[model samples]
Target chain A: METAFTPFTSFGGGLAIGLGAVLLMLGLGRIFGATGIMSGAVFITSRAELSWRLALIAGMVLAPVTLFFVTGQMPVLNVPVSPTMIVIGGVIVGLGASLGSGCTSGHGVCGLSRLSVRSLVAVPTFMVTAAITVFIIRHVFGA
Target chain B: MKLFYALITGLVFGIGISLSGMMDPAKVLNFFDLAGTWDPSLAFVMGGALIVTFVGYRLVWRRDAPLFEARFRIPTGTAIDRNLVGGSALFGIGWGIAGFCPGAAIPALGTGRWEVALFLLAVTAGFYLRRLLAPMQTARAAS
Candidate 1:
């Protein structure tokens, strides 16, 4: 398989993500964890906090279309998993995120930035496991 | 005001994820394939984000309060428990299988893909499942 390495775009996009996270922290006093925000929007009893959560998710959903207008091209997302596999993956991710209390953005980006010890442990654990899974699936299973 | 800020932050985050090609599962999976055809661009993405957020957090923490809220809602957990490790391990496997973390998955929904939709549905179900299981665990502990 050919490798696709685009450092410029990746770095630029990363900066934007960091900026977005910082903005959320400084402006709203909230951690920019997608799962947390999404779950809050879905399950929270407080109606007052719902609007911002909905807005954030709506913005995320519309971003691709907004980019389409700016760049005249849609993002290419090639998910190489079957429908069943995708559903199973999603369930595990959702459950794990809830139990772990954060996802990539929460634990990987924000938590690391804050120098949290638990995130420090969680990030490496997940990254290593992710690598192992990929190795098994692609190399051993040859899927 | 808070809603506006959240919307803007989320939009920027979505665009960043799209531009960084993090939304592409193949690229994400390639990053995990270190022994095979490894792409190190994602590392740069994380690095760039981490640096900005590291600095951003330090500066933001200097302020007494957020611009729009009374207090910052940072995580206070400090334990390295089974839930953290086990949940992270499960999340990593799911991420490796699908290459779609919560951040990327939310934005991918804009593409209107059936697989994305299915995965999201499963994610919601998983969230509810976890919610339902929490009380059972509490009951068992109490007993």
Candidate 2:
């Protein structure tokens, strides 16, 4: 369960993510909120909206393929939780994000960058809860 | 043009996520587990992203509008209401239960794992459920 600090790689990745957000704002005048984008894709409220959402999602799905070409293999990610837990957690996240109108990418990243007061409040609220949840799951339930 | 630009933007974001180790649910979970073998790497991802996006969005905002869009679609709401707080709190619980945020989980779908697929499906159902319950909330507000 021990993990080494990954400052260098994490920073490098963060920079790339920042650049991507910059591109969206600069080019499309839009925020790069993952949940919002995906929901918009799911609902497909407008034809104009569909193009950008689908395009963005396609690009997201293609990332591993891009990495495969670069590294000659797929990147395997660890879920670290039970399948039922993943589904339950995922549903809660989905519902919560919709109700809150943003998630980490939306409120934590892009929203904070813009200095939105709502995001400033939101980022901490979620961080605390997530930490508490982890505490309960790991220590109390010992999952 | 908007679609193309969005696609490329998504590409960069997805690649950044893959590179940053955000895809690893354990890595993310450890960040929350302060009493355990905590990994502080995820902070850098948010920090690195904020540095660029903070400056980048500002620079972009100086422009009259984005290249592809006629206007910025920035969120107008600023109130720190119950919905914002409560929804985010719920999301935090879900995130703690599973380290996979929507941003991380969506791209990991490329792994073609049934777990990821099911998790996402559950998330979609949650969103649909929320939409179904929205009228109740609206009616309450109207009353």
Candidate 3:
């Protein structure tokens, strides 16, 4: 399948994420880690922690409603993989992100932004492995 | 007030992912498929966000404390041990297989897909199971 090269839109989107992450740091002195936010939303018992996480999740879920108002259409998403593959992948991601203590937003964006040595190691290792996995699936197995 | 900031932050992030088209698993997968259909949009997204986040973080850190919080609650761990590398490798494999990072999936929940819901549920299960196994891994590390 041919992919669209969306330089402008992607860059614009990056700016928005940067702004969002910066806002979190400036206002709450927190790193905007999505997985952490998600898991905490489910597991953390602190009243304050839960409140903010729920609020953030609500915003995320409601964002498309806002998009509908402005763009007159909701953003469409495509899941190319089968449901079983999606479930298996999701389970693996959970184990991995939990063990690693972060995911893309955490390590890739927040940690790398801070220039943390640990994250510096993390970013490349994951990238190469991701590339290799794709190679295996696409070229080797020919999926 | 803190909750409000978090809500806005999430909204911004949701908007970013939507506009960047990261919510579309096929688009993300195409980025990994270098030989078949290479999309450089993801690179631009990362590069653009990095520029802003790198500079923005520097500025944010100049303050003694955040606007609402007394101190930053960032991670303190610096270890680059087995868990770090191994966990990241697993996460990368999962990402390559499905093209859905937690960062993208959380926001995509707005799209109301059954696949997203099921994947998220599986992830939650994986997280708890990993947490349960944490002590064993730590004991192994110590021994």
Tens-digit lDDT track for model 1 on B23-138?
A: 88888999999888899899988987898899998899899999988888899899999889988888898889878888888888887877778877887777897898799978
Clashing pairs in 2: none
Native A-B contact fraction in model 2: 0.82
Fnat for each predicted structure, in order: 0.79, 0.82, 0.70
What DockQ values do the models have?
A: 0.80, 0.81, 0.77
Tens-digit per-residue lDDT, B1-143, candidate 3:
87887888889888887788777888888888887778878887777777888898889989999988899888888899877888888888888887888888878888887877877887887799788998998898899
What digit string (tens of lDDT, one per residue) describes model 2 on residues A20-44? 9899889888898988998998998
Give per-residue lDDT, candidate 1, residue B79: 100
* Per-residue alpha-carbon lDDT of candidate 1 for residues A1-143, written as tens digits (9 for 90 to 100): 55578999999989988888898899888878888887887798787788888888888888889899999988888877888888888888888888888889999999999999989999998999999999999999999
Worst ten-residue run, lDDT, model 1 chain A? A1-10
User: Which has the higher lDDT value, candidate number 1 or candidate number 3?
Assistant: 1
- List where candidate 2 sits over 4 angstroms from the true fold: none
Positional deviation of B108 in candidate 1, in angstroms? 1.6
Residue A35's lDDT in candidate 3: 81
